[model samples]
Structure formats: C-alpha cells, structure tokens
Target: MISKLNLENILFLDIETVPETAHYSDLDPTKQALWDAKSRYQRKEEYSAEEFYDRAGIWAEFGKIVCISVGYIKMEGEVRQFRVTSFYGDEVKILNDFKTLLNTHYQEQKYLLCAHNGKEFDFPYIARRMIIHHIELPNKLDLFGKKPWEVPHLDTLELWKFGDYKTYTSLKLLTNVLGIPSPKDDIDGSEVYDVYYKTKEIERIVVYCEKDTIAVAQIFLRLRGDQLLQEHEIIHV
Candidate 1:
C-alpha cells in the first residue's frame, strides 16, 4: 500500500510539548483542582496530582507545543534527498508557522501528513491547541465533516499495527527493530518538561524533535522495502 503512494507528497513530522506551567503550584487554585480531577483515574493511588504534574504535557489542556519539526523527500539529480525544518518557541507562533507551511505547500489532495502515532496524539493535540489559540484550522488538519477515507493523515504506528489493535509499539522500539538510528539518543520524552522549564534549552528540544521526524520518514521507507537514506542525503533547513 505504501508503495502505491507518492513519498514526495507526504509531509513527515513530529511535535514536542511541555506543561503549560513549570510547576503545579503555578496554576491557579481552580486549575489545580481541575488537573487533579482530570488525572485522577490515571494516577489513582500511585502518585499525587502534584507528583504526576510532570506529565501534564500529554494532555492538550495542560500543555503547549514547544516545537514542531517537519520533513519531506525530494529528488536531486536522480537521487532521493530528505529535507527537515522546525518551528519553535511560542506555542501560538509555532502552530501558526506550521499551519502556514501546510497551506502554502501541501494544500492539495495528494499531500498527506505523516507522523508516528500521530492519529491519536500529534494530530489531535495540534488541532486542540490551534482552537485554544483561536487560529483557523488548516485544510489538511481539519477533518470536521470528512469521511474516514478522506482524512489525509498517515501514522507510522498505525501502519505497523496492520489491523492488530491490541498491540502497541513505541517509535523508539520500532525504529530499533528496523535498524533506523535512535532518535532518543539526546533526550527522551520523559525529560522534555525539565529540559524546557529548568534548563530553558528549547533549541535542544527542537533538535530532538527534528531527529524524530527524520526517523519517522526513515521508518516509512523501511516499511516500503526501500533503502534507508544515507546521512549525506539528509538536509536540515
């Protein structure tokens, strides 16, 4: 199925998010209560709401995107090359820049957005944040009345599932099994909050995000039984 689609038409991407505030105490009393109630089921007796606050970034309501890195394949002198770029900093600006990129370059039926576990996490999270910022939904991301078949989003995780809904696979694990370079070499998702709030090194996070985006593209190529890209073939813009 992947071989039937044009790889050049797909926009491969990934996003990094952090808690809206550095600490749980930073939220107002009402919001603190809401976070506790919202996360009670997942936390249970294992940890207090404050203890689990580090994970707030997983929930769109309590998080903001710090970086959204995207990549695509192009041809250069009969050789396939991959190019990547990132939008970082303020959540609103990051989202706005991503939306503009989508509208400007990929606003066609043939263009598809691809990411790892994107259907459940990256895709919905971006849309919710855009709504919170009062930004109009980009054509590719908006799925209001579209039929299920019309959604132009591709998920590497879903493709790997192959109709087995009970199993779960992390991108790191899949990439490892497929022999793609590890994207988690610098930092894993668990430490993103600390890296953002305490260290204030967003550039580091953006680099990590771009690595994941590149890995997603490479994994897709592996799935299609194609050659993995050589390091020299990757261009960071």
Candidate 2:
C-alpha cells in the first residue's frame, strides 16, 4: 500500500498543543478537581496535579491545539516540492480553518491524512477537539462507520511498529535512523508549552510543527525506498 500511494494525494500533518491554560490555577475549581482525579494514576504520587499540568497537552480533554501544520508533495519541473501551511491561534479558529482546508482540497476518497503516531494522537486529538468546539468533522476525519481498511489515513509510527506492539518509536529517533535531519534542533515537544504560554512565540511552534510534518513526509519517502528531500526542495506555503 505504501508503494502504491500517490504522494501528492497524501496530506502530511503534525500538531502542537498546550495545556488549556498557562497554569493549573487558571482552571476553575471544578476542572481542577477533575484534572486531579484524571491524572492520579499517571502522577503516581511523584507529582501533584498542579505539578503534572505541564504534560496536559497530551490529553485531549485538558489541552488545546495551538497549531496544525500540513504539507503535501508537489512535482515542479524536475524537483519534488513539499509545501507546508499552518492553521493556528484560538483553538476553535484553528480547527475551523483546518476543516476548511480539508473541505476545500482534500474532500476525496483518494486523499489520505498522514502523520507520525497520528492514529493514537494527532488524528483523535483533532477529532475530539472538533467535537468540543462544535465543529463538523471532515469526511476524512469522521471515522464512525468506515471499515478498518477503508480509513484513509497513514501513520509513520504505525508503519515502523511492524506488528511489534510493545515497542514505541519517536519521530526523532526514526528520522535519525533514516538519515533525515532532526526536527528538534530548535525546541522539542516538551518546551512547546513554555514557548507558547511564556514567550508567546507561536510562530516558533508553527515552524516546529511544519518541520515535523516535513519529516513525516520524508520518512514516508524513505520507507518507500525513495530519496529524502533536499532543503531547497521544501516550500513553505
């Protein structure tokens, strides 16, 4: 299936999320209690809910997406150009804009959404957030009645798993093995919350998200036994 895919038909994407609020105290008392109960097992007495709030972005219920960067391959003359664009700011606005992009350009059976660990994280997170915001799910994202094989999505992390369900691979590690440049040179996922809430540098997060999307595309290409894209070949749209 990987080899048969048309690269241009796949929209490769990555998302950046932060806790719903800058501090745990910012949440209402009711939400604070809910968070405390929700994180009990994960915290395991090592950290309180307030201390663990930094990691809230991983959970769809307590976090909001700040950026959704997407890229698609385009053939230009003799080069393969990967074009990237991002929808960011106010979670609802970001989600609405992203849905617009999907409705406008990717509303086709042949089009597929690709991401690293997307099935578990990015894909569901987007769907859950959309529901929270009362936004309609795009055809590609709404997976209610579709058969397993009919789902039009690709996950690089799932591809690397190769049926070994016990092991997990980070995009950084996979890209390193595949000889793709590291997308973490500036800041890693852990620092995104700080950069967003403290520095207010959403553009930096957007750049990071775009690089991850590009890396996902490059990794897919490498898995297909194709050459990795050159820096000059990536076009930011």
Candidate 3:
C-alpha cells in the first residue's frame, strides 16, 4: 500500500509541548484541582500532582504546543529535497499557521500526515489544542465522521506494530533498530519542559523536533523499501 503512495504527498511532522505555565503554582486553583484529578491514575501514590506537573505536556488540557516542525519531500529542478520548517512561539499562531498550510496546500485526499505515534499523540494533540483555542479544524485534522481507513493520516509506530497491539516503541528505538540516525541525541520529551521553562531555548527544541520529523519520513521510506535520506538532502527551510 505504501508503494502506491507518492512520497511528496505526505507531510511528516513532530511537535514539542510544554506545560501551560512554568510551575504548578502558576495554575489557578481550579486548574490545579483539575490537574490533580486528571492525573490520578497515572501518578497514583508514587508522585504528587505537582511532582507530575512536568508531564502535563503529554495532555492537551494542561499543556500548550511550543513547537511544531514539519517536513515534506519536494522537487526542484531535478533535485529532490526533504524541506523542513517549524512554527514556534505563541501557541495560537503556531496552530493557525499550520492550519493555513494544510488548508492551502494539503487539503486533498492524496496528502497524508505522518508522524511517529502521531495517531496516538501528535495528531490528536494538535486537534485538541486547536479546539481549545477555537480554531476551526482543517480537513486533514478533522476526523469527526471519517472511517478508520478513510482518515488520511499515517503513523510509523502503528505500521511498526504490524499485528502486535500490546507493544510500544519509541521513535529512538525504531530509528536505532532501523539503522537511521538518532533524533534524540540532544534532548527528549522528558527534558522539554526544563528546556522551555528554565532556559527559554525554543530554537534548541525546534531543531530537535525537526530531526524527529525527518526521522519519521525516513522510517516511512525504509518501510516502503526506499533509500534512507542522506544528510545533503535534508533542507531546513
């Protein structure tokens, strides 16, 4: 099925998120209580809500997107390139800009969005965050009544799962096992909060996110029996 798809029709992406505020105390009393309740099962008795606050970025209600890096295969004058770019800074603007891109360029059924664990994380996270800001859902992200196979989205992790539903694989693990370059050499999801909240290094996170996006595209190519993208072919636009 993948062989029938055009590589240029797919927009590969990854997102970086952080808690809405720098600290737990930064939340209002109502949100603080909500956080405590929402994370009850995950934290259990091992960690308090405040202690688990760093992980709030994993949930859309308690988090905001900081960076959304996207890459797509493009052709220019007989040259093929995987051009990558990022939308960072304000959350609302980040989302609106991405929506514009989808609505303008990738609205067709032929264009699919791909990410590692995207169906589980990146895709839904973006949709939820858009809804939080009252942004209208683009055709690609709006999955209201679409059938499972009708949804024009792809997940490398889901592909990697094949028929096994119980196992989970991180992007780092997949890239390593597949002989692709590691995107986690600098920072990972766990340290994103500290990097954004403490150091204010958004560009650093943007680079990390773009690497993951490229890695997603590479994984798809590999799964389809194509060559891994060379460094010279990856362009940061």
**What lDDT score is found at residue 25 in candidate 3?**
96
If the candidates were sorted by their lDDT against the true structure, best first, what order would they fall in? 1, 3, 2
Q: Each model's TM-score?
A: 0.99, 0.98, 0.98
Please provide, for model 3 over 65-91, each residue's C-alpha lDDT reduced to its tens digit, 9 standing for 90 to 100.
999999999878778899999999999
Query: Is candidate 1 or 3 superior in lDDT?
Result: 1
Tell me which residue pairs clash in candidate 1: none
Whole-structure CA lDDT of model 3:
0.95
Off by over 4 Å in 2: none
lDDT of 1 by residue, 81-193 (tens): 89999999999999999999999999999999999999999999999999999999999989999999999999999999999899889989999999999999999999899
Clashing pairs in 2: none
lDDT of candidate model 1 versus the reference:
0.95
Collision pairs in model 3:
none
User: Could you give the candidate ranking by TM-score, starting with the highest?
Assistant: 1, 2, 3
